[model samples]
Target: MRTLLLSLTLAGLLLSGCSPLPAPAVQPTQAQPAPPSPTQPPATPPQPTALAATPAAVPSPDEATPVAAPTSQGGSLPGGAIETLDPQAIIAATLRPDAPAWLIPADPELADMTRYRLDVTLAPDLSTLTGHEQIRYTNRETVALDVIYLHLFPNLWDGGLQTTDVRVNGQPITPTLPSGDDILGLPLAFPLPPGDSVELGLSFSIAIPAGEGVGNYGEFAYQEGVLALAHFYPTVAVYDAQGWRIETPSPQGDVIYADASLYEVTFTAPMNLTVVASGATLDHAAAGEGEAIWQLVGGPMRDFNIAASADYQKVSLQVGDVTVNHYYMTKDAAQGQAVLNWTIAALGLYQRDHGPYPYQELDVVETATSAGGIEYPGMVVVASWLYRDPNQRDFFQSATAHEVAHQWWYNVVGNDQLNAPWLDEALAQYSTYLYYLDAYGQTGGQGFLNAMDARWARVGHAAKPIGLPVGEYVNREYGAIVYGRGPLFLVALREQIGADKMTEFLRQYYHDDAWGIATPAEFQTLAEAVSGQDLDALFQEWVYP
Candidate 1:
């Protein structure tokens, strides 16, 4: 969730944005919706300190609104960047993403999860639209899969009854839930034959009012030309080696993933806008005059995302096989090389410390929406506030680092963020601290971590942990715990297990749960089992104690 806002805000113009640890994740109780570059710095052996000046972030434009296009500006890539191409295929090959290849690695069904490649075309009025999804399945269990279920989260966006037309392998069908597990309740549903695989294709219509989703617009926000979509479709909840861990989205919340998959997205918009999405661009084909199709190919990922705009300043950074891209608003703080340079250093440092980045290229798009940050698989959207003034550059850097780390935590590890929001987001938060430590140092890192802690104290203490259920927590408190307290929990856990053991524990945890969604209980079992010690109390403190 920490990375989500960045994934949203950057490409927005105060026009579209994702919420950050809001007061309550009270969604409509129905389905819900929600919404980086590296630059090179001097080889100064980046310090693991605050990304910038030493004050807690003041909810300025950069913090609240989404990213937007630059205003009449010309900013070049920083010192060590190559901004010429999208580099989508290069990375796809490296990730070797293959969905529906049941016998392959990105096995969604096996994990009780599946993903679809989507193509959408929206009318200018925002009230009418079209979408297509490519679905794949991989069975995680031995059950003979008689059907395939899909999610149409957008159904929740409107009135939960948008007319949709689906085609599985080119054959038209309607997979909406019927009977007990009503497809209408899910927004989408479908089935496939047992132990076999086939393509699930869909073409549907959707819409939104002009300037909708501007601010706190119910469970989700929607506006023509600007969209923040989540839970817009229906999907089968995940049930794996663990259990039925189906999570739902609520007000200002996010869900969890167990298995990461590949995403290939193609979107068409009025010719004047720019498109930013998950994965690399496979094709930028010309449609009729005044129109174009942006083909995005992303794989070895759990999910995919795409956003479009007419105004944006494109930027890219490449540091030893790792390349990242960022979009700045014409109305941002600083433009050009300044942004690029900082990002390059951030990306390189991240690559060296954690693990080889899984994706080939990173895309950061600015939005007019609000919120500090949000993360998708390979793409992210950030607010323009970080670029609103030169005084705020460092926060921009910190925000960038935080979102990039999500590719590892929430996306790759695939944990149940609802039950243990701390599992996914907290890990990402710690990852941010790691970035600061690498870029700044102990003093700087601690300071930044403390600031986040302070924010949590203000919020978490005021509300109760979201207790409705693990699924309900997606729109609940683990953010405060996982992101805010989760790191502190790690800090303490490190003390208990010894730093060396912490490393060994993570190595084993990753090895066991690689590309699979993990539950809090599963993680706890792993931790205790690895340390040869009991940690019920430790987890209790971090969560409820």
Candidate 2:
């Protein structure tokens, strides 16, 4: 969740001075999402310490067992030709019938652990949002659940969020706020047993903050005619091996840890504003004289984000069956196209190397935020400033590629971002290396590594252990270790075990943990399983060191 802030150094790049114009409200249309690109076996498997001419060969559909392999005319191709594709279609094409085996599990016992139906109305001035959420949750844990916690992430900002009333299973309940934090807890009137479900109706409001961020920590910002609403909802906290994860937002890095669940959102806003959110758009219609309602469905994803602006424009391209969209303002027309190309290329490269992207669409929207790029499921908010300087084009590309990589590392494969930031962040940074390798080959890939090494040295090369919580390091040290040194660990592993085995290890890891949170220990176990050698010494030097 690194926020790459690009200052508006280039003049006349944003149309912030221009008067806002009304945008026409149109019904949302469905598009076909892409399928996995076909893979061919390697001509000769490279020996240890050798990089393969092509990327390491991934498991073909036939060898992965019981799971139905993609068929030329059935799984990949659909309805005689390219027909309609939605989240369900994307899942059917990309996921195995027994997807729960490796990906996010949806057993009857745990399918509805948390389900949210949020109905929201945006103010005409684009400064606030009023909403009520209908949340249906089940006590899926083995023990009797006594309390439920909801995280109000936006509350961390000044004039941020307020919860009005809450009811559990239709009975009004007083919510208790945690001390010096943004968490609200509701003690269950009666202990909720496993397999039992309850409904919570909550009312809340959020006021979008106005101003530039201090660093890479802007959330409720309204600037340049764009409104970025990230982590704005009162989300249910995750209960895992350590119980409820009720931690508050931290300044150093991402503080969210959640289980993938379903969401159906209804957003009502001024007719002129366009809504871009996680998942797929199910419906859109006129709400009233000057308002419209958009129905969106997403998940089982860890989080959902919605961004809107009156001045936003979009350019889209079809890759295989999937549609990749780049949203930008009038000033970023040229940069918008560039982002779209890089997104499409990155998606293809990751799909070929890791696995199929199990979503119908991916959006890269330009926004003003603290981060250079912030990732959400099937969507990301990219810094508009990245487009201002022509000389820093590579920086823009690397940032965009890194965020897109999170679709697999952070989105599909869930993680405890608060406890083990390296699990996803390090892998995402390494993914940029992979993208460079796939796009520009060995020479360019090594160049990216050399740049990373130089940056690490400039940061004084502290040699801190990469496997640590977000709070352990300062912001700069966090970036230096996780984004810079963390990737080098993978490079060293590649050198030790060969590129083919390293890629195979990653493929296995992705396949096994596609739908669940994984820790460094789990990764090490998988690494040893695939490489047939102990990596304790290696991990000690770079990761645990």
Candidate 3:
């Protein structure tokens, strides 16, 4: 299977800082870096061509398995074997525990997880974030390693971060050129071979990300005292079948599965300031004076994310013994109930249908600027203006549903969002529609179907074959093929097979691929196999010919 590519384009992020790696120190013994050249817009590279062959001789039933449907046919995704499951047991298990603990493949160069900690400071006044990353990499591989490479993540930022210095276990490493790229970027890189369990500490800074225009985020806008802090720290890059999944720009959010880390993140702000973040907070007491500590202890997240708003009003609710907190600017509080009500409804439906909420607390905040509602592990940040409109419930409802569903699709049911975007994006978008169907019946679903219809009408005109890798198509075109056409195919297939059977098939698919990623072709194969039908031609029409 082709290695998946995942990226989060936190572009148009407003930043101001000097050029180079970052002010914080990086791993030492590095090559010497050249003087900073004038940074310019990067030219797009030729898209990837097909690597695996086209579909060949059909598989015999005796040889048939879900794996053959996708991976063997020039398609990507590990397409690993499927497993049977008990639905009741799956539902009863906590969402965190329910995920498959994907075994770390026996790789010779990398070490297993030991422990990690990160301290990051964001300077709103400077629009720059300073961070310190600490991790223990033990060389479990047989080879004796020398140099190790580290990734300064969220490298997809428009201009990327510039590091001023680096230290290796406190020893400084020189550089040939600033260790990075424009198209696919990671701020710094280190070298490592084998049998070395060592600690890596790095100090780096990225311009505080804001969107294009003033208060403009991707597809959303910002309000007062609201801040969206993302890709704000140095992170370990991913290397797999496709090599280092470095600082590349991808349309969808990132596809990450960080092993484990103990995080002690602190935010110091003046009094009356409340913040909502990714992990647990150590609030010794609820004091209502002076500056407060927004301390976080993130247990198992690939990266840590947090949003702060000094003007935010705090509200809390409990859903099934799990506390759900909300932070929004005071002025936006007028419509806070609207979001809270819908979120509660969506949460209840998701738990009943798929699984339980995994984390102890779920935070929903209104960011100063951000894309449409985006989910981050247990927390979610969404635009408040959209939800405030009483008539715009469909947009709010669906966005809310989409982000929440991401908790299951990308977070637990892990898949690479870059190279194989269709895997999670399509699932999250459509699942929201499913939730709408469950809640408001056919009418609620019609809006999404209408969106699909609009997407098809717009994209079908330019009808590029969906067979090409996701990055080959325009962002909008990919949306049409994956989110619109893909779900419509599923809806049609469901009609062919009774819902009872289809639901069972979905359950099985979920159980089998819990921690695994997938490709579109594999899904077609599974749908056919589960329904005792064929989808070859269907895929030919919708995805490839």
Candidate 4:
């Protein structure tokens, strides 16, 4: 969700101007009107176990044996090829058998990427979850590492997370929560050298919080039968030049800052519920009585998220090889259909303007969230309330486009959203403008731009720098500056350069930094390079000033 209050302001601003273009009267080429199989009888839940009982000595690239190519189901290759010392089995288990070929990175530069295998079960009441996770963490920094930190996001909410059976390299170890309950620090028995990988395992149970009044747009909560699970697991903290990024998240911005990693998850849930998650589902099978297990795999993704509900109805369309699913309640069928159409339009526009979306699937789900929309890896969550309000349709459409834009800005090419919220949020907002321009022409585009100007007007159009940390802004200032003034800066840059150069810059930035972390400095440097002009003055006036 961007800012609910700003969304209201934007709705009025757009309604006062030219109305948005009518949605294209196109129907899905294929639709799934029925839900999945009914709930089965309950059975015994699976227990957590280490992916590999004993750690094996990983071979160097030269000494590694060449494995067979990935099969139809996404297969894993030796991590040695990518520069990590993780065993081949660990890598194999992390990728989905049905993962699209493009989702796997062939680049040698991404060798130190993390890999995770998770086996979790959701309770029948949607009130809690129990799981075990195995992580392959590589020390990508130049220096050796003594301790690793994991962010326990649920600890900050109403209900909490309890972790047990912590182990490192098959050996039991005790973990400490040094920086509050949220940050779990594991002291390695031996310092992990640079380029080396360590296997960590743990079992956890989370008491899912209720959505109302919860923080971060209530992304990690259960509300009205919908479960929005974002950052519900133990996520490794990012270690960069600033050392560990474990700072307490401000109430105004996104919380998770992570590296692109591979994930293989087996989630068991009540059969009556429909689960829409990041990546492609390789298999859906009955686990026991009224439960089913979904086998999913995604790679080179910043984070993983899942939205499950017993009441969800789905509509699907195939855009090329990508399967787009829109999940919503029956009462919101019209809005859900509109969201699906807009999502398809935005996906096509972004693919043409920025770069190809590598994933094989994309999901836009109507969730019980406070924010307008929240973007995940291959999925985005649209707030359900937006569907019930006829006057808020404009904001709803724009928010949908904005979240889809995050596929490129946040998921494919990530940044430190805590410190540089504008890196993705601003770009996403600008991309929403482009979407309107492409889909609805100048009249539609101008109306949306007018809404942005209105948002900036909330702060009296201050000349504040768009490059401030989330904590630096208070109240509505975070939305006013970052979401409002920041995108305007991008429009200004487009004017300073040329429309053609601006387009080139976006494509190059996305392609070059795909599945990698980007910084403001790198963004400016790329702009200068692509435009063949120094961008110091422009960046200074808008970003640094």
Query: Estimated TM-score per prediction?
Result: 0.72, 0.81, 0.68, 0.83
Ranking by lDDT: 4, 2, 1, 3
lDDT of candidate 4 at residue 114, scale 0 to 100: 85
Question: Lowest summed-lDDT stretch of 10 residues in model 3?
Answer: 1-10
By summed lDDT, which 10 consecutive residues of candidate 1 come out lowest? 57-66
Tens digit of lDDT per residue, candidate 1, span 1-545? 32333323222211111225321223123321232222334235333322321121110011111112212122121111111112233233335232123213532333333444556775654445566555555555665544554444554444332534554444555555543231332221344334555455555565543363433342234442344543343444565655444334554545534356555455676666566666666556668767777655555566666655454556554544445666655454255455555456656665555445565567676654445567777766665544563333445565666776676667767765545556656666666666656655555566566656654564555334322233444332444444555666777787899877776776566556657767777878988988999998877755563
Off by over 4 Å in 3: 1-116, 124-126, 137-160, 164-171, 175-198, 209-223, 251-264, 270-272, 284-291, 388-391, 461-470, 513-534
> What C-alpha lDDT values do all the predictions have?
0.51, 0.67, 0.48, 0.73
Best by lDDT: 4
Off by over 4 Å in 4: 1-104, 107-111
- Choose 1 or 4, whichever is better by lDDT: 4
Task: Flag the better candidate by lDDT, 2 or 4.
Answer: 4
Please give the distance, in angstroms, between residue 265's alpha carbon in candidate 2 and its true position after superposition.
0.3
Which 10-residue window in model 2 sums to the lowest lDDT?
15-24
User: What is candidate 4's lDDT per residue for 268-322, written digit by digit as tens?
Assistant: 9887777888866656777798888887666668888988877777766667656
Question: Residues 481-544, candidate 3, lDDT per residue (tens digit)?
Answer: 6665655665666677767667766666665554345555667777888888776766676556
Better of 1 and 2 by TM-score: 2
